[model samples]
Target chain A: MALQLTRPVLRSQPRLLAAAQFLPTLMFATVAAALVELTLLRLLSRVAIHIPDVPALRGVYSAAVQAGTVTFPVAALLAAALVTVAAMAMLPRAPILAIPALALLGAQAALLVAGESALGTAAHQWLLAVALLAVLFYSTSRRMALFVAGVGVAQAAGLAQAASANLAAEGGRALPLSVAGAGESLLLVTLLAAPVLVGPRRWSRRDVIAGGVVALIGAGMLFGNASTARTLALWTFGLGMPLPALLYAITAGAMAATLIALLRTGAIERAGALTLIVLGGFVPPNSYQAGLLLAGVMLLVLEQPRGPATTD
Target chain B: MKWSKPAVLLVGALVIAGALAGLTGVRTATSQAVTLKAVAVADKPELNPDWATWVKIPSVDVQLTNQAVTYPKGGGTVPAVSLKAVHHENTLYIRASWKDQTENVPSIDMAAFTDAVALEFPGKSAVSVPSFCMGQPGSGVNIWQWKADAQAGAGSAALAKLYPNGYADSSGFPEELTKAALYQPAFGLGNPVARTDAAVQTLVAQAFGTLSAAAAQDATGAGMWRNGEWSVVFTRPFSAADGDQAEFAAGKNTNLAVAVWDGANGDRAGQKNVSQFVTLQLSGELVKAKSEDWGALWFGAILGGVLVVLGLAALGWAGVAGTAKERA
Candidate 1:
C-alpha cells in the first residue's frame, strides 16, 4: 500500500512542476510582450499629435491604436474561433485537454491584454502569476506556497518598476533606476530584505552552493551590466527590470520539460500538435526553423514513456 | 489478385511522399515574387537629385509600436519610403528617398540623431522571407545601411574646396558653457572646424538583436536634404556573395525588407519604421542568378530518407506479423 502511494506521488511531481513553473513563466512572457506592443501604440499616438499634417499617417495610427484597444477580446475570440473549428474538424483524440487549454488560452490572452495603465498592467501580470501558481502548483506544503508567492510578488514588483517611465511618466528620466522616480534608494534597501525574509529553511550542501551561485549571477546580471549606462545586456521595461532572454529561455526549457512529462501520459503528441500550430503565430519561421519543429515532434514520438506513469 | 497489407503499406508511403514533394514544388514556384524592374544606368547615378521619376516601392507606413506595452506610446508618423533600382556590370544600385524635414545625420554629439535608410536582403531565396525587422534565426540577412551623416561629411569636404573658411562661425555660445560642443576647426586633420561628413558604414547581420560591428564597408551612398525631404542612392556589388551576406543577382527577384531610421526619435536596433518583405528584381545582367532552393531541398531530402527507412521497417514487420498470424 505504501509502495503504490509512493509511485503516484512520484508521478505527480512533473505535473506539479508544470503547474508551478511552466504556466507562470509563459504568463510573464505574454505580459512583457503585451507591454511592448502597448508601448508602440502610445508612441505612435504621440507622434500622430505632432505630425497632424500627414493625414494618411494619422489614419494608420488611428487604426493601430483603435485595433489595439480591444486586443484582448479580439485575440481571444480569434483563438477560440480557431480552436472551435480545429476541435470540430480534426476530431482530435484528446478533446478534454483541448477544452481546458482553450479556456486558459482565452483567460491568459485576456489578462495579457490588460490595459488601463502601469498599475493595471502590473496588477494583471501579478494576478496571472499568482493565479497560475495557485491553480497549477499550489500544494498542501506551506514552504512551496511561500516560495511561489515570493517569486510572484518579486516579479510583480520588478514589472511595475520596469513600466514606471512609460506608464507613469512618458519620456521621463528613463534610466532604469530613475524610471521609478526619486524613491528607489530607500525602496531598494527595503526590497533587498526579501532573501532574508524567506525564513530559516535548512539547506543541503548542494542547495546552499546552488543558491549562492544563482544569487551571485542574478546580482551580477542586475548590477554589473546596467542597460541605462549603454550596456545592452539588460532591458529595463518601463521601471521593471525583467531579463527577456532569461525569461524566454526559462519558458522554453519549462515547456520542453512539461512536454517530456506529458509523453508519459500519452498526451504529448496531441498537445504538441496544437502547440506547433500556435507557435507559428508567434515566431514567423523560415524553412530551417521548421526542421526544429519536425525534430521535436519526432523526439516526442520516440521518447514516449511506456505504461501508466506513477503519479504525484 | 488481392494485395497483401505489407505491399499496401509500401505503396501508401511512396504515394504520400510523392504528394508532399509535388505540393512543396508548387509552393516554391508560387513563392517567386513579382520582379522589380531596374533601369540599367551609367555610374549608378550619384545622389541622382531628381525625385520626380524613380518608380516607387509601396510607401508603407513605418508602422511602429503597440506590439509591446510601453509608457510613452510608439509610432512617430514616419513617412512612407520610395525606391528605384538600376544596375551596371557586376553592380546593383538602389535609390531610396523619403520625407524628413531635419537633417539628423550621424554625429558624436550627445543629442544628434542621424537619419538613415537600410535595405535588408535574405541570405538565400526570393521566397523564404523571414521576420520583417531582421532575418529570423537559421536565415541570415545582408544589410546595406546608408546614413545622412556620411553624405554630409563627404559634402563638407567638397564645400571646403569650393568656399573654405567663408562660413566659419567660431562663437558656439562658449565651449565651456555648452560642455565642449563648440564646432570650431582649423585647416587640416585636427581642425575642430573641418569635421567632414562621416562615411556611412555598411553592415551585414542576420537577426533582430545584433551587437557586432562591421569590419568592412562594401556599399556607398549619397543623400541630399532640401525643402524638408531627403533622397539617397545606395550602391553595392551584384554578385558579392561571401560568408553570411546574401548574394544579389540580375534577372532574379530577391526577397528584401526596407527600414528607415529617424534618429530624432531615438530609433536604433528595434525602433524604426519598417516595410514588409518586398521583391527587388534586377532586370539585365552578365550572369544568370542561381536558385535559393537549397534550404528546402535539404529539408525534403532528409524527410524523404527518413520516410524510406520507416517504410522499409514497417513492411518487414508486417510480413513477419502476417506469417505468424497464418502459422497460429
Candidate 2:
C-alpha cells in the first residue's frame, strides 16, 4: 500500500518537477535573453553607440542576428514540447482533440527541423489556427476558451489577408479595407480591456495609485511629440500604422484600464505574456519580435491552469 | 523567496520602460546585409532592362512584407524584388524586377489600377535615417516612383490599347473644346500621374499620406513587362537641383527602400509590399559616415532616464503607502 502511494507520487513528481514548473521559467529566460540581444546588443547599440565607421560594432550586430537565427529553432522546439505535454495530459480524456493536437505538434516540429518558416504566416496559418483551437480544449474557464477562440480566428483572418493578394493576383476577389489593419486595431482594444473585464473587484488604494501613475506615463509617451511620440505609440500598441485619431484614443484608454486591472489583480506574468504575443502580431515571423512572441505563447501554454481530466 | 506586489510591479515597469527605449530603432535591424553595389561603367548602360551589362552585374534579392499599417492594406502579391544598380558618368541607374503573371495597365475605367514601384531615399537634409514607411516629420524622404500606365501614356490611349473593339464618338465635341487645356485639368496642371510624357515622378513625403510632387522633376524611368515578369529601371543624376531630392555621390553610402504594387491585387497608395532599408553603395569605395546628430540621441537617452525615474518613484510610493496602511 505504501509503495503504491509512493508510485503515483513519484510519477507526478517527475512531471511537475521536470516539466511543469520549470518549462515556463525556461521559456521566459530564453525570451528575455533573445530580447536583450535584439534590443540592447543589436538595435540600441546601433542607434546609440555603434558608429557606422566602427566595423567591430557592425560585426556585433551581425553576430546578434546570427544568435537570433539559432535561438529561433530552439524556441520552436520548446513550443512543440509544450504542445506535446498538453496533448499527453489530454490523451486519456479527449483523444479526439489530443490526437490532432499531437499531429500538428509533429508537423510543426518537422517544419522547424526542415528549416521552414514559423507559424502565423500564410503557409502555416491553418496549422497554427487548428493547434490554437485544440489547445482551447484545456482552457480553465469558458471565458478564457472564448478569448483563445477569438484570437485564433483573428490570427487566421490576418494570415488569410496576406494570402488574399496572391489570390487576387490569380483572378480571385479582393477586400476593400485590409483585414489586418482593422483586426490589429480591434485586438489592441480587446487585449488591453480583457483584464478589466475579467478582473477581481475592489481595487486596493495602492494599486489604483500605481495604475494612475502608469496611465500618465503611457499617455505622455504616446501623445507627447508629433514625430517620436507616434513612433513610440506604434511600437507599444503594435496597431496598424498612420494611427487614426479615434482609434488612437480608444487604444490609449484601453491600455490605461488594462494596466490598472493587471496591477489590482496581480496577474503580471500572464498579462505580460499575452502582451508580447499581441505585439508580435505586428511583424513577420522572421523578425526578432516573432522570437519573443513564440516564447510568450510557450510561457502561456505552460502556465495555464490544468483543468479536470475530460470523461469523454 | 516571497515578493510583494509593489516590488513585482516596480520591477515590471522598469523592464518595460527599458525595453521600449531599446526598441525605438528596432526596424533598422529587420533587414540583413543587402548591398546594391553600383558598378562603374565607362558609358551609360542601355535603358533596356535586358541590357547586356545588367547580366554581368550582380543583383540583390530583397524580401518584402505585405503587412502594411495604413488603409487599403492587403498585399503580398510580389513576395520579393531583385535590385541591380550601375553608374555611368554622373547618372545612377537602378533596375528592379519582380514576378507577376498578369500585366496590369491602368485605363480610364474606375476599377482599373496600375502596377507600380517606388524607391525611397532620405532627403538630403535629413540628419538621421527616417522611417521606411513614407517618412517621419522633420526628416523627409524623396521617392522616385514608376507606374505601368504612365509608361503606356497615362491612361490616355489605354482604353484604345486595351479594347480595340470598343469605340466612343468624340466627334460630337467642339474642336476648340477637344484641344482646350480645360479638357485635361490635371495634365495641364502638371500632375505627374495625368502627364503622358513621363513614366517616373519625382516625389517627396514628410510622413504617411504626405507624398507630393517635388518642385523639381529631375528623375525619369521606364518599365517593361515580358515573360510574366516586370522589370523597371530608374535613372537620375548624382546630384539634385535642391535639397528636396536625394543627392548621391560616388563613395558615399545611403539607405534604399523599395515598394512594389500589384494592380491585380488592387494594390495602390498604402496597399503594397515594402522592403526594409538596405545599404546602397555607389561605384567608389564604400565610406561609412559618422552621425552628427547629438541632440536627438541626447533626447532619447534623457527621455528613457526620466521614464525610469518616474516609474520607480510612483511604484515606490505605492509600496510605502501600502506598508503604512498595514501598520495602521
Candidate 3:
C-alpha cells in the first residue's frame, strides 16, 4: 500500500492536517453508527410503529411521524458536511470524498424521506445509477464518472420527464410508463459500467470487494431460501441454481477484476477512502456493512504509515 | 475482536428471523402424497401421476409483487402445484407439477423465465420444525430445489424442440451456449450432471446469502412440460447426514412446505406463492396436514431486496481487503 503523507503537506499547518486526517473518518463512523442505530430501531419497532389516519390530530401526528423518519440520516449527512468543512479548512485535498459521499448520502436520505412519491421514487433510481457509477469509476476515472453524470442529468431531466408527461396525457397507462422508467434506469447503469469496464483504468480493490460482497449477498438470498432458489431455477430461468449464482458472480467478478486492474495499473489516486465513504452510507448488510466501510476508511485516514526502518 | 461485529450482525439476523418464525407458528399448509409401487427416474417418461401417485396440493397462493425493489414490474397468482413424494431403492422422490401458459425456459431473451418449485424441511432431526419461511434465517432448512431448465430427460435438446424458429439463422446460434458444463449451476465448479446427466437439480441452503453453492448435489429431478403444464420430479437418497437436516428415512413423519413460481407472473425471489408447514406421512395410515387460513402466504412473501444489494457491495469490498497485507 502506498501512503500519501499529510503531515509534510501540513508542515506549516499541523492543526489542519490533523483535522483532515480525523474529520472524514469520524464523520464516516458517525454516519455508519447512525445507520446501524436506525436498523436496530427499525427492527425493534417493526410491529410497533403504525400511525393510523383518523382524527385530524391523529393524521397530523402520523404525518409528523412519517416526516420525522429522515431525521437521523439527514443529520448524519449534515454533520459529515460540517466535518468536511472543518477538514477542508486545513487540508486542501480533504473533502475529496465529501462530494460523492454526500451525494449518495443524500440519495439514501431521499429514500428515507418520501421514497414513495413519484418524483422522489423517480430520483431514487437515478441516484442509484449514480451510486453504481461511483462503485465503477469514482477515483479511477472521474472524467468518465462526470461524463456519465452529465448524460444521466440530460436523460432524466429532459427526456424521461417529457416521456412521462406525454404518456400521462394519453390516459395514464402505468405499466408501459413504469417499464420506460425502469429501462431508463437500467440503461443508465449499463452505460455507466460498460465504458468504465472497457476503459484504460486498472482494477480497483474497493470495487472488487464491493461487487463480490453484493454478489455474495444475492447468492445468499437466492439459495438461502429454498422457495426463491427453486422458483428462479425451475420456473424463471429453467437453468438451475448454477445459472443464477453464476449470473451474480460473473457480474460482481467482472467489476472486481476491473477495479483490481485499475488499482494495479495505478490509474488514479486514493479513491478507496471515498469509495468506502459512499459504501458506508448505502451498502448495508445488517448495519455493520456501514461499520466495516467506515473502519476501512478510518484505517487509511487515521493511521498514517510509518517510515522505513533505519539500521543502527 | 475482529469477528465480533460481523458475528453480532449474523446473530442479529438469526434472532430476528427466529422471532419472525415464532410469530408464524400458527400457520399450517399441506401437500398430500401417496406411496409409489415402483422406483422413479428423473428423465424417465414412464413416471406419470399414476406411477408417482399424485396428491394435488391446492394453490400455495400467498404471493408478492416486484414491491421488493429487484424486478421493476411483474407479478401474478401461482396456480396450484401437484406434489408427489415416494421412496424407492434408497431414494426419496418428490415431484411438483403446476400449470403455466408459456414454457419460459431459455432465458437468452427478455421477459423470459422458467418455472421453479421448492420444498423446505427442518434442517434438524427433531420433530419440532421451524417456520417454513426459510427457518428464521439461520435456523437452518435443507431445501431441495428443482428448476425447470436445469432438469434432465424431457429437457434434452429442449431448446431445439421448442424453438425451431427461435433464431433467424441456423449458424447464428452461439456454440458456447450449447454445453451444460458451461452452465455452472448455482456457483460451484465443474458439473453435477457429469455422471448422471440429470437436469433437475437439488441445492441446499441455510439462509439468505451471499451463500455458497452446496459442495455436492445429493438429489436430482427432471421437468416435463406439455400442454401448458410442468411436472418436475426430485429423487434423493433415503438417508442424508442427520443432525441439522431433514431425515429422509422410511416410515418417519416430518413437516415440510412447498412454494411455486410462475415465471411469467414476474414471480421470482420472495415474490411468489408459498404454503405453510404441512405434514409428510412416510408410512402407515396417511395424515393430511390441517389446512388453516391461507392468509399466512402474504406474511412470508414480504421482501427486502435492499439487504441483498448491500450484501453484494460488502462482497466486493471483501475481495479487495482479502488479506491484512492487502489492507496495509
Candidate 4:
C-alpha cells in the first residue's frame, strides 16, 4: 500500500517540476522573440525608403518594435523546440531527424523575418502542420509533450500581454474587455486540457481537479465579458470569428495546452492535440478544407501499430 | 553531381532574368522628358527711335522706344506721322508733349509741362509710366514733375496713374495739368525751375536716368540708355513670343522677325524675318514673339535612370535568391 502511494506521488512530482522548469523557458523565449522583432523593425525603417511622411514612418517603426516585443513568448518556444529537437536527434543518432529539426528551425526563422505578417491565419495553419509533423517524428513522447506544453504556456502569456498592450495603446475600455475575454478563454482551455494530454494516462484526483478548475476559470472569463462572450456564442451558433484573429487565438491556445501537457505528462500527446486544435481553427467557416489535413495526420498516427503498454 | 548541374543552370538563368528586368524598369523610368523656356521684349525706342527707349533685353529680343511729336499751332492737326519700321520684338514708345502758352509762366508754373512717356506691352492690358524726374546723372533724385491729375486727359492716363506723382482719377481734380510742381523733397526734386525746351530735355534725360537706376536695382531689370537708343544682352539663350517677335510698323504696315542670341556667350544667333506683314489701323503698339524649344530632357532622363537601376537591383537580388534556393 505504501509503495503504491509513493509511486503515484513520485510520478506526479516530475510533472510539477517539469511544468516549473518550462515556465522560465517560456519567459526567455518571449524576451528573445521580442528583441528579434524590434531589431527587424529598426532594420526595415532604415532600408524601406518608400514611406513619404516622417510621422507615418515613425508610427510604423514603433508598431514594428511593439510587435517584436510581443513576440517573445513565441520565440522562447521556438528556442525550446530547437533545443529539444537537438537533444532528441543526438539520442537517436538518426540523420533524418536533422532534416525535420532543420525544417522547424527554418520555419521559426521565416516567422521571425515575416513578423506579424506571418501570424495570419494561413501561416498559423502551416505552423500547426509543422508542429504535428514534429510531434510524430519526435523520438520520445515526453519531449513532444513538453514541447507542446511549453509552447502553449508561452503563447498564452505572450498573447495576453500583447492584447493588453494593444488595449492600453488604443485607450478604450471595450476593446480591452473583449480582448481579455478572448485571452482568458484561450488560457483556460489550454491549461485545462494540457494536463490530460501530457500527464500519465491514468490521471489522479489532483490532475482532474486542476483541469476542472482551469476549465471553470477559463469558461467563466470567456462568458463574463459580454462582447467576447457574444462573439463566442455567435461562433457556437455556426457563425465564425474573423479568420485571422480566430486562427491566432486557436493556435495560441493549442500551443499553451501543448506546453502545459508536456510539463505534466512527459509525452508528445500535447503536440498531436495542438495540431488538432489548430487544424480545427484553420477550417474555413462552413467549409472542411482543414479536415482533410487533420484526417491524414490522424491516419498516420493510427497506422502506427500499437506498442506494448506498461503500467505507470 | 547531376542535381548540381541543374542547380547551377537555374541560378544562372535567374541572375540573367533579374538583370533584364532591372534594365527594363530603368528604360521605362527614363522614358519621359520635361522642358521650360524664357523670353524677353525689347524697349519701345529700338522699335521706333523717335520715342525714348527706357529698357532693352537683347537676350530675349526686346526693344522699346518713346517719342513726342509736336504739332505746329495750326489748322487741322498734322497728319499723324508714321515714324519708323518697329521690329516685332520692339514696341513704339510715346510721351506726353506739353506747350507753355503763358509768357509770364513762373519757374514753378513750368512744372505743369512735365514730359512723361507711356510704354504698353502687346499682351498686357495696362501701361507702365514713370512719374517724377530728378537731375541728369543723379542717383535716386527727383528732377522735375507735375501735380497729381496734371496730365489726366492723355491717352495713357491709366498708365500714368501707376506713377506716384501721376494724376489719380480717384482724387477730385480738373484732371488737367497743374502749375504746382508735384516734386517730393524726399526724392530730391523739391526746387522749382523755369519751364523751357531745355528744361524739358533735362527732365527727360533725368527721367531716363532714374528709370535706368530703378531697372538696375531690380533683378529682372533690362539695361537702359540716357539717349533714346538702348540694347539688352541676355545672360542665357531665350525665345520670344510671336507678338514680341522683333517687328517694324509704320501706320498700317508691320514686319515681323525672330531674334535669337546668347548674351553670356556673346553669340548673336541669326535673326529670321517673317514673310507676311500684319497691317493695323493703330501706330506705335507693342508686339511679342514666343520661342518653341526649351531643354529639360536631360534631368528627366537622369532621375528615371537612377530609379530604374534601383528597381532592377531589387529584382536581381530576388532572382538570385530564388536561383540559389532552387540549386540548393
In candidate 1 chain A, what residue range of length 10 has the lowest lDDT sum? Answer: A1-10
Order of quality (lDDT): 2, 3, 1, 4
lDDT of 4 by residue, A1-312 (tens): 000000001233343324323322322332333246335532342223334549977687656644532342333333334234232322222223223334434543453343222022223333333333332332123332343434333333323332222222112111232343453454345434544433344544554455455545545645454333323332222112323343333433444544444446643433433333333232212112122122223222222223321122
Candidate 2 runs further than 4 Å off: A1-312, B1-33, B167-182, B285-328
Give the alpha-carbon lDDT of every model. 0.40, 0.57, 0.42, 0.28
Runs of candidate 3 with Cα error greater than 4 angstroms are A1-312, B1-75, B125-128, B152-188, B191-196, B210-212, B241-244, B285-328
Compute the TM-score of each model's chain A versus the native chain A and list the values: 0.28, 0.63, 0.35, 0.35
Instruction: lDDT winner between 1 and 3, please give it.
Output: 3
DockQ of each: 0.02, 0.03, 0.02, 0.01
Quote each prediction's TM-score: 0.36, 0.46, 0.34, 0.23
- Per-residue lDDT tens digits of candidate 1, residues A1-312? 000100111233343322222222222222332333334432343233344458798677656754443332222222233233322221122222123323433443443343122223323333322222221121123332343334333333333343232221111121243323323222232223322322223323443444455545545544553322111111111222223334322333333333333433454343443243223211111211121122222222212232222231
Q: In model 1, what lDDT does residue B133 have?
A: 43
lDDT of 2: 0.57
- If both were scored by lDDT, which would come out higher, candidate 1 or candidate 2? 2
Sort order, TM-score high to low: 2, 1, 3, 4
In candidate 3 the C-alpha lDDT for residue A262 amounts to 47
Q: For all the models shown, what interface RMSD does each have?
A: 24.8, 20.3, 20.6, 31.0
Residue B286 local lDDT, model 1: 28
Give lDDT tens digits, candidate 2, residues A1-312: 000000011243443333333334433444454454545433342233214548887677656644543443344333344445444544433344445455545554453343232121223433444444444444444555555545545554554454332222222232323576665555555555555533445556665555556656656655563333443333333344444544555554555555466645776556555655644554333323433444344344434444332221
DockQ of 3: 0.02
